[model samples]
Target: MNRKHFLSSFIAAATVLPTFKTLANTVESESSSFKIPPYLKQGDTIGITSPAGYITLEQIQPAVLQMQSWGFAIKIGDTIGKRDFTYGGTDEERLTDFQKMLDDPNIKAIMCARGGYGFVRIIDRLDFSTFQKNPKWIIGFSDITVLHCHLAKNYGIASIHSKMCNSFPDDWSKAELVQIETILSIKNALIGERMGYTAPAHPNNRQGKADGILVGGNLSIIETLAGSDSDLTTKNKILFIEDTGEYLYSVDRMLWNLKRSGKLKNLKGLIIGGFKVKPDDAGEEFGKTIYDIVSEKVKEYNYPVAFDFPVGHQRNNFALKCGANHTLTVSETGSVLQSF
Candidate 1:
């Protein structure tokens, strides 16, 4: 090639290379810049609101009393007990209730009353300016995963992924209730000694060690938010996912989407939480279990993958700090997930 042709090619490559490098660096910085919210203490007022499905005041009374018993003042939002079809309230009503709690200085933490299918409707309409100034824990799982991913991707604030008011047992002796309280008080998680669980290993499990900020919640929500502004960044991040009531084929499809989108291509680790899938109809099987679908999708990556880690849609659901760094170890014996 002539000097003139070579010169043109060199100049074009130089101009585009820096732009790609800069973009990669920006994404890395944004993913690692999360700010931990202040931990709750006695006398701290907790605000309960429904960002998704409807909940009756009577249904949440047990949770209210539980918070009170823990010495935290409870302020129930107006959205509760108000119904607009399947949602707790109209979009405007839910947005107003959540906005008030976000802006209120006295409410140290915002607890979701339930998670159904409405947070996405009003998530874009709500503002988080005041929330950034006085960051506090936003708690719940499932539909609340929308908030968890949005906060991590945009605002860089950590939130709680745990049982909400709807999941509080009628009798507090259940182990889940204790796990919920331990996370809220932040005594255990703050010291990096968050409660850990063990489960029998699946044949498809990948054994290894990985440490990165643990970020993920319901698999359905994560898949629903994919390619949107709230999509998660799994690069060098420990991605944990759980779901409930999904068909086997549907689970396979969602995991395929994550793999194709490059979300599962690079990860420090992968945790397969409780899928709680529905059984196929008689003789019309989807031909794969939840574990099979997940393992197949992530087969290319060697990161630690642990199955059935006691999370999602079950009485044993435990609290996970959505944006906090954590260490994961997978082996023949079992797997361990602990906050760092």
Candidate 2:
């Protein structure tokens, strides 16, 4: 070959090789196995931090006492009693407290004290380098869905979606059976028990079976994070969503957003949890039920759809291990979700 021709080919290969290498790295990262943080054992410390809403120390005592009874020590973050309006603390304060817990080697798991708003304000600023290396359980639902989705997208790490400190009953003896069962579900998940839950069949449910990673929380929060760094990748996953106090029209809009974003495509299954819709005003009624809205959006898909699968803001809300592989079975009689 001529010297000029050889040189031109070499330059072209050098440029193309780097691009191919980069694409390969991206694919490898996306297909990597999810990392499950070490489960808790008796006497392990569980740090409690308020990364979202404001909660006084007194408000968390119920949780603290309950966890203590379960044989786990508690490390209360400074933001527990600190408040800045609706937030647990200023953005800086909340971020620092959460970061400390993430980096602490002694803390086996970090349980969010409560969920309201403000996680997104600090999510971008908090560093995960140390936490990524020493992965630990991050527990909460509601607004904490932001963290669950963020960790899944960026690090492929597992976290718990369940009731937080704010949900603990002040008196266990007086607590309802459902509340006690839901709370115990967290302990079972933390201690590495294979968790399974069953929900009664709804007439709207589509019968089928699937096995995939579990991913989802509040529908509104999931929609809010769409297109961001924390947006969920729902393809080939079992997604369960629940929301509280949204109007039927608003729920329809969010479902449309999910459909338009291609979030509802592909295989696996869907679980629709509790949706506490707000009543419409006298003159402005949206004439569609939650079932109708979801069915319309997902009618084209063949994957199974389970309605009222008991994970949400309601009393039946049980602990779910997000980013973990799960088997979903939906039949005419009922639905079963089993974590592996």
Residue lDDT tens for model 1, 156-247: 67788888898766766654643454334332332233445555667878999998888899998999988777888878889989999988
Root-mean-square deviation (CA) per prediction: 13.0, 13.7
> What local lDDT does model 1 show for residue 78?
98
lDDT of 2: 0.85
Tell me the deviation in Å of residue 338 in model 1.
0.6
How does residue 298 of candidate 1 score in lDDT? Answer: 84
Q: How close is every model to the real structure, measured as TM-score? A: 0.86, 0.91
Candidate 2 residue 84 Cα shift, in angstroms, is 0.4
Candidate 2, residues 170-241: lDDT per residue as tens digits? Answer: 999999877888898888888887778888878999999998888899999999998788888887888989
Highest-TM-score candidate: 2
| Model 2: worst 10 consecutive residues (lDDT sum) | 6-15
